[model samples]
Target chain A: MGEVKNKQVILKDYITELFKESDMDIVEGAITLELPEGPNEVLLKNLYLSCDPYMRNRMNKILKIEGPATLLVGYVWGFTKWEEYSFVPSSRILFKIEHTDVPLSYYTGILGMPGITAYSGFFEVGLPKKGDKVYVSAASGAVGQLVGQFAKLSGCYVVGSAGSKDKFRFSVFVNTSKSFANNLILHASPPLHLNAYLSTTILQIRYFPEGIDIYFENVGGKTLNAVLLNMRINGRIVVCGMISQYQSAQPEGVTNLKKLITKRIRMQGFVVRDYYPMYPKYLEYVLTKIKEGDIVYVEDIVEGLENGPAALVGLFNGRNVGKQVLLVSRE
Target chain B: MGEVKNKQVILKDYITELFKESDMDIVEGAITLELPEGPNEVLLKNLYLSCDPYMRNRMNKILKIEGPATLLVGYVWGFTKWEEYSFVPSSRILFKIEHTDVPLSYYTGILGMPGITAYSGFFEVGLPKKGDKVYVSAASGAVGQLVGQFAKLSGCYVVGSAGSKDKFRFSVFVNTSKSFANNLILHASPPLHLNAYLSTTILQIRYFPEGIDIYFENVGGKTLNAVLLNMRINGRIVVCGMISQYQSAQPEGVTNLKKLITKRIRMQGFVVRDYYPMYPKYLEYVLTKIKEGDIVYVEDIVEGLENGPAALVGLFNGRNVGKQVLLVSRE
Candidate 1:
C-alpha cells in the first residue's frame, strides 16, 4: 500500500471561495490520479490558468439579464474551496485540452479560448472587408495579438491599444515587422480618411478618428464609451472581452448607445464553444499561417507551478506582456 | 391688359399651406392661363390642402444629417402654398384618389399621401406576421386607421390607441363590420406569449401588461418612450410621425433606447416616397379590399377652406376621429 501510494502522482491546484472578501484564496482540493472515464475526456494537468473577461460573469450569481451571461462559473466554483459553490464543473463533462505543437502553456492564452474567441469574432461577426479599418483594445494581451494578425491576413488596416509605451511599441513593431517576416506582404496604401496618421493611443483617443468600421472590443470602460461615439454608420462591434471592468463591482457606463440607432451597429457576444464546428478549418488556416512565418506568436511564460498564482494575478495589473502562461511541469 | 388677359381664363387660385408654421409659406402666387404641358403634371386648381405628417420634413431647415436630407427638405418645400404644384398623377408618383367619384377632399385623407403613408409603413415596415401583437398610436387619425385595418387584414390580432373611446370602438367596429375581415374568416391565433391579453390604451401604462411587437408610430412622446421599454426582441418601430414632439420646443426624452440593444429592435424613420412605386398595386389591393368589404375606410371630412387651419391643428391635438381633410372648392 505504501509503495503504491509513493508511486501515485499528487497535483496542486489553486482555488477561491464564497468568502465576503474579494481576494482569491488558494485552497487545496482532492487530487485524483485515476483516468477520467469519458472517452473524449483528456486528463489535462492544467499548466496555466486563463483569466478572462467572460469569467467575471461566472463570478456573479446568474441574474436573468437580457445579455449573454457567463458560462465559466461552474469551473470557477468547482476549483473554489467551499462547501457550497452553487456551481461546479462536472469532472467527466469538462472540456479536454487536445494536443498542440506549440508550448502547452499556450492553452491559457493564444492557443486557448481567447485565441479562438479572437479568431471566431473577427472572422464571423466582423466580416472584415479589405482595406476596412480595424481597432482592438488591450493589443499586447492574449486575444489582441492573434486578432491583429488575423486582420492583417484578411487585408485590413489594423491598429491596437496597450497599457504602456513599451507594450504599445512592441505591438506596433510586431504587427508591422512580423507580417514582413512571414512573407505576408504588408504594403502601405493611401491613408484612408482621418485615421491614417494616428497611433493606437490616438486612435483610441479619437476612437478611430475617421471612424472604425470594425471593432474588436476587449478592454471596456471609458475606452468602450469612446469607441461608441466614433463608430461609423453600420459598424460591427465584436464583444470579445471587457477586461477593464471584470474586477470592478459595477459595470462601466455606456453613454453612446443612441448611435446604434443612427448607425445600425450590430454588437454581438459569443463563446468559443459556438465556434467548435469551425475548429478544423481554423486550425488548418492558422497553422498554415504560423508555419509559413506569416504569424508571429509571443508568450510571457512563467516556469514552475509555484509561480502560477502571481503570474495569473499579475495579468489584472498588466505586469506581463504577450501571452501570460505558467509552465506547470517539464515532461 | 384686361383685353390681353380676357383671351385666357385668369385662374387666380388661393392655395393654403397645410402646416402654417412649416417653412413653406402658403403664398398665392399668381399665374395666367397656361397650356397643359404633359399627362403626368396635372394643372389642377388649388382646391383642397392635404395636411400630413410627411409635410413636417418640408418645414425643417435642411441640416446635413445622414440620408437624403436635402432631397427630403426640398420635397417638403416644393409643396408651398398658392403654387401650382405640378406632380405626376400616376400611382407611382402620387397615391391617386381611387374611385374619383368621391370628394376631392378624400385626396387629402382616405386616398392621398397620408393613406399611402399608413399603407406602406404598416404593411412593409411593420411586417405584421399573423398572431403578432401590434400597437398603433393616433389610432383614430388618417394613417393609424388604415394601419389597424391592414393589420387585421393580414390576420394579425390588432389593438389600437386613440384619444377617445369612440374612435377606439369605431376602429374595432370597422374591422368587425367588414364582411371578409381576416378576424371574421379563419380566426387568427392569439399572441404566443403570456403578457398579451391586456387592453391597449392611449395612456402609456397599457404597455406594461402586454409588450408590443410592431409599433406604427405616428405619435411620439411618453407613448414612444413607453413603447421603447415594452418592445420585444427584434421588434420593429416605424416612425411615421412625432406629432407630439413636432410642435414642442424640445423633443421628448427617450431614456429607454438602451432597450433597443438587448431587444435588437429596428426603428426607422422613412417617408412614403420609399413605397411610392408600389402605390398602384397598393391602391388596387386596398380599394379592392374596401370594395369587397374586407377592409373599412374611415375619414373625418372637414368642411370649407376656412376650417382648414382648425382641421390641420386638430391632427396634433388628436381632435379628429379619423383621416382629416379640408374641403375647399368642392370638385
Candidate 2:
C-alpha cells in the first residue's frame, strides 16, 4: 500500500498546569498502510481514541501519543497513538471487539478500559450493599457514569456529581491540570478555586445528611476530604484516580482521615490491570445490562483526527460532557 | 451491708489540650460492698485500671470517668471507673479471667481489648502476607506492641517505633496531645513540632528503602501521612486509633493520601467489638504465644490508685511506657 496522509497530535511538552490546546501540536505525517512482518502484529486503522485521567498519572510524567506512522503500539505502551494509521502488537491489545452491534466508539469507553475500571473499582473494591448511599465524583465522565449506573443496579441509591448530570448536585468537574472551569451542574453556587472545592463539596453533601456508604472516588484532593467527612460507619471509598491532583506539585492534604477510624470506614485503591482476568465475565454482564436498558453510557466524541488534541485537553475542564473520545477514522 | 471507703480516679472536666495531672482528681468515695439486685450484677473489688488511647478518642468529646460510688456501669458505659473497689454489672465486664497462670493484669491488655485489637486489625484488616515489610507506630504501647509481635508471628519483617525499644529507629511516642517531647528512642534528631512528624517519618522510612507493605496505624495525622509515602504497592494500613489528634481541637491534615491510589493501598479501620466473636480463638493463640515467650509486653504500672492520675497524664508526653497500667489492688 502507498503512503497515506496521516494527521497527528503530538504532545509538545510535559504539562505543568491545566492542559492547553497550545501544549499539543497538530502535524501531518504519512504511514504505509501495510502490516509489517511480525508474529503478533496487526495494522489497526485507528477508529476511536480514548482520553483518560490515568493516562497521565500512571505514566508518571507526560502523556505521549505518537502521530501517524507509529512503528510500535502496545497496551503496555498505552493506547494506539492519536493518528489515523498505526501498527499494533496483538499481544499488547487488551481485548478484541467481538460484538459489533454497539457503537465502535464504545470500545474507547463503556466497553474498554474505563468500563472494566468502574466494574472492578465499584463492585469488587467498593463492595456496595443494597440500599447503600453511593456517591460518585466526575459522574458525567466515562468511568464515573458507569459507577453510578452500577450502584443503582445493585439496589443502592446513587448521587453523581461533576459536569451537567442533572441528577447529581454540585459540578465538581476536575481536569488533569487541577484547574477547575465554569460550573455546569452545581445546584448552588459553584466553587471557583480548587481549594474551595472541598468546603463546597462538604456543604453539598448535606443533601445526603445521613451519609454516604460507598464513595467511587475519581477526583481526589478536596473532594476526597469532603467524602471522608460524609462517609457513614463501615463506608467504603474506591480510589480509582486523583485527576484533580495530577498537575499538582503537592496534592492537597485530606484532614478528615481520622474519620476512617471513627466511623470504621474502608478506603481501597485498585488498578484495572489486576481485574482484567475477569473481563470476560464483566463483558457478558455489562453487554446484557446495556441491551436491557439497565445501564447507560454517554460519549463526547470529537470527529476527525485533527480535533484529538482539543478533545483531550477538554477533559481537564468541564468542556467535555461525557467519555472523551476522538474519532481518528470511521473504519 | 457495711459501706467501704473506695478510692477513685475522677476526670475533673473535659480536657482542652494535653492531659494534665490536674485533669483527674483522686478521691476516696464510699460504696456498699454488696451485690446489686440486677440479674448480672457483681460486687467486685477493682484490681487494675487500664489507660488506653481509645478511652479518650472514641468517646467523641472529653474522656469522662465517674468517681467510685454506689452507681451503675455497663460495657457501653466505657471501662469501670479507674477505682479501688466498685459494684460492676457483670454484663459490663468484657470477659472473666479464665487462665490464672498468666498475670491477672493481662485481662487489661494482652488477654483483653488490646490483644484482640492487634490480632483482628493485623490478620483480618491488614491481610498481611509472609515476608511483608510491616511498620508499627506507638510500638511500645498495648496494641502497637502486639501488632509488631503479630507481624513477626506472621513471618513478616517488622520495624517498630515509639518509646525506646532500641530495635526500632525513631521515637514517635505520640500522646493524646499533639505536643512532642524529648527524644527517647530516636537514633537521629527527633522532630520537634507536630507538623515535622510526617517529613521525619518519610525520611526514616528510607531505612526500608524497598517500602512498607503493612502499616499498623496507631498514631493518626502526620505519621499516617508519612506511612503513605513509604508504602509499597498493594500495601495495607490497619487504622487502629489517632492518639496524636485525640486532644487537638482540629486534627492535622493528612496529605499523601493519593499514594493510596498510586500504590493501590488498602486502609481499613475496625473496632474491637467486631472481633469479640473470635476472642476464644485469639485467646488460645495469644496465650500459647505468651507462654512460649514468643511475645513480650511492657507495662508502666502505678502502685496505687492515687498515682493513677499521674500515670494517665504521663501517656500524652511519653512519660508512661508500655501498657500504662494502674495497679489499684492485687488479688
Per-prediction TM-score to the true structure, in the order listed: 0.59, 0.86
**After best superposition, candidate 2 residue A243: deviation in angstroms?**
1.9
Q: State, as a TM-score between 0 and 1, how close model 1 is to the true structure.
A: 0.59
Give the per-residue lDDT of model 2 (tens digit) for B15-106.
Answer: 66667788778788899877688687666677777778766653335344433211222211125667766656666644656677877677
Top candidate on TM-score is 2
Alpha-carbon RMSD to native, per candidate: 10.1, 6.4
**Candidate 1 Cα errors over 4 Å, as ranges:** A1-25, A31-45, A58-99, A103-152, A155-281, A293-331, B1-27, B36-130, B133-285, B297-330
Docking class of 2: medium
Give Cα distance to truth, residue A22, candidate 2, Å. 2.1
User: Taking the tens digit of each residue's C-alpha lDDT, what string does model 1 give over B1-331?
Assistant: 1111111111122223333423222333344445456665433344455556444443444522110100011212113242232332323232223365544555565555676788888787677798777777677677877787788768765666555222222222223544312322211233321112222342235333556788887766556666776777767787777665565434444544444444656665556666667767776776666667666556677665445555555665556656665554443
DockQ of each: 0.09, 0.64
lDDT per residue as tens, model 2, A1-331 = 7799887777776666566778778899888877678778777667777877765553345444433221222322236667766666767644666777888777777877788899999989998889998888888888988887777777777676774222223553322221122222454544344335545544355446788899899888777887787888899999998777776776777777778887899999998889888888998999998888667678888887777767766676667777887776664
Model 2 gets an lDDT of 0.71
Ten contiguous residues with the weakest lDDT in model 2 chain A: A174-183
